[model samples]
Each structure stands twice: as structure tokens, then as C-alpha cells.
Target: MPSVEAGTAGPLTALSPIRLEFAQKAFIVSGGRLLLVRKSASDPFHPGRWEVPGGRLEVEDDLDLDDHIRREVWEEVGLKIDPGPPFHLWQWFMPDRADLAGRGQVRVVATARRCRPVTVDATLENQESDDHLDGCAWVPLDEAGTYDLIPSLRPVMRAFLLAAG
Candidate 1:
């Protein structure tokens, strides 16, 4: 569980010497609350679990890391946010029998604040992917643990709450 603090200018040099691929996620916070999404049970990867909004890098569409975060947050939750500097970085490794085994990933976790009033619409629940997201909500930071969040997110959430406080 290697976690990088906010505002890192370069990769996690201390954890690993090997070059690794990168991904990004946003712990979107608003008014002392955090946004979390529920994965569809029909999906394979941690289905029915809670997670922050994010996705793998789209080299073809996203021009850079910040662009990817902006696009993914909107596409996943229909919220406009001003993503702050990355708050944490997780070195991800799937089990040998896992679908994404052998390959590793570095998740650049950033904090963001809502820029506009969230517009509730049908599109928010209707995810475009087959098994990506099913539902989402803004939970109070203190109460976020009641939901079954993704395992890696628990520590990140704790660190974030402490830092924000």
C-alpha cells in the first residue's frame, strides 16, 4: 500500500525503480462530502463495490493527465469539477489469476471540488459502458465508511479526511 502525498511533481521513485504505466482517479469532494460510485454487479472487476470516479488513460482522446480526469469525471458522474493536484498514488498489482494479471498500473489519485450544482438527470445513472458504473452519490466524509468501498480506497479516504480537516 504505497500512497503518495498531494502535489508530487514526478513518479513514485522511492517505491519502484521500474517504469510503469499510469492511470488517474478523482476523489471528488464538495461541501465536506465525497462522491462515490457503485460498480454494476454485472461487471467483472469488483462489481457492486464503491469506487471513486476514474478510468485508464485514453492516449487517443485525452491530451494529458488533467484532461483525462476532467473527461472521466464528467463521463462517469455528470459533474464538472476543478481537479486539484494529485493527492495519492497507488502501485496496483492484480493477482496471478486475475483478468489484468502480469500487467501493473499506477493510479494517480487526485482531489477535486465541484464547480457547479450537480444536475440530476437520467444520464447520470445510465452508464455508457457494459459494466462500469451503475449508481453514485455524495456521502458525508464521516459516513463514507458505512458503504462497501473498494479496498484500496479506504486508506486513501482516511488520509484525505485527515488532511482536509
Candidate 2:
């Protein structure tokens, strides 16, 4: 990731006025299978849907994006990854309840990175009491599309499969 120094003139400077949230998702692969986690039934956004491990970047996190992703992966699924460069990028706008009094929706920009697990052991430990993730599996890459994934992730899965082939 590149940063713009304060007062520097560039095309990205125009984005200063907009509030964008950054998030990272990992496609952790091992033994021709991809990891997926099921969102809890009570999750407001996409309950019961399957998604890759990762989450939004918090302001308090380390400046390094890779480190931030590593932390999120560990926290979400109890696994370590060697994150590769982002293979896909996507964004969506949703109502921002925190800023409902002012702006109605906030744009969430996210990157889906290709990753490899540090070890062949793909056993997942999802702490149900701590987060919305309730279950996990290492699905074969060719059979991934049959699972009910979040809407935004469908194309990502297709692209990944094609690329992996």
C-alpha cells in the first residue's frame, strides 16, 4: 500500500473528503482446498452465509496492511497465513448507522488477497462465544461455488478458481 504525504498534490487528494472504510479478506488455500467460515445466524449483515476469513481494518491496528490481515486471520479462524498481493478488489456502499445522523451510507473498499496456510493442518478453531463465526471447512476449490457464499464473494470465487486452474 502507498501513502500520500500531507500537502502533496495528486489525484488521490480528491478522496480526502470522503470517508472510506478499508477491509481485507483472505483466500487461504492448502491441498487444493479453500477455507470458508459460516456467519452466525444472528449476524445482521449476512447471517448463515459463508465467507473467507478477514475483517475491516481498525484505526488502532498496525500501519502494515499485511500485518493487519495476519491479525484478522488469526483472530477470526485461529490460523496463520503467508498473504500474497491482493488478487481482487471490490467495494459496496451500505448504511452507516454510526453516522446515521449525518451521512446515510459509507463506502467499504475491500481487497481479497491470495494466501497460503503456514502448515498443512487446516483444522479450524472458531471461538463461537467471541465472534459471529460459528463453523468452518476446507472446501475443494472446484466445489466452492455450490456453497451459499455472500453475494459479493461469488465473482471472487469464480475468478479465483479460474486463476488457480
Strongest candidate by TM-score: 2
Clashes of 1: 0
Off by over 4 Å in 1: 1-20, 95-126
lDDT of 2 by residue, 10-111 (tens): 575544234679989999998889999999887878899998988888878657898988888887888878989899999887767676465456788999
lDDT of 2: 0.82
Task: Tell how far residue 82 is off in model 2, in angstroms.
Answer: 0.8
Model 2 ranges off by over 4 Å = 1-18, 100-103, 120-131
TM-score of every candidate relative to the true structure: 0.69, 0.81
- Ten-residue region with minimum lDDT total, candidate 1: 113-122
lDDT (CA) per prediction: 0.66, 0.82
Q: In candidate 2, list every pair of residues with a backbone clash.
A: none
lDDT of 2 at 165: 93
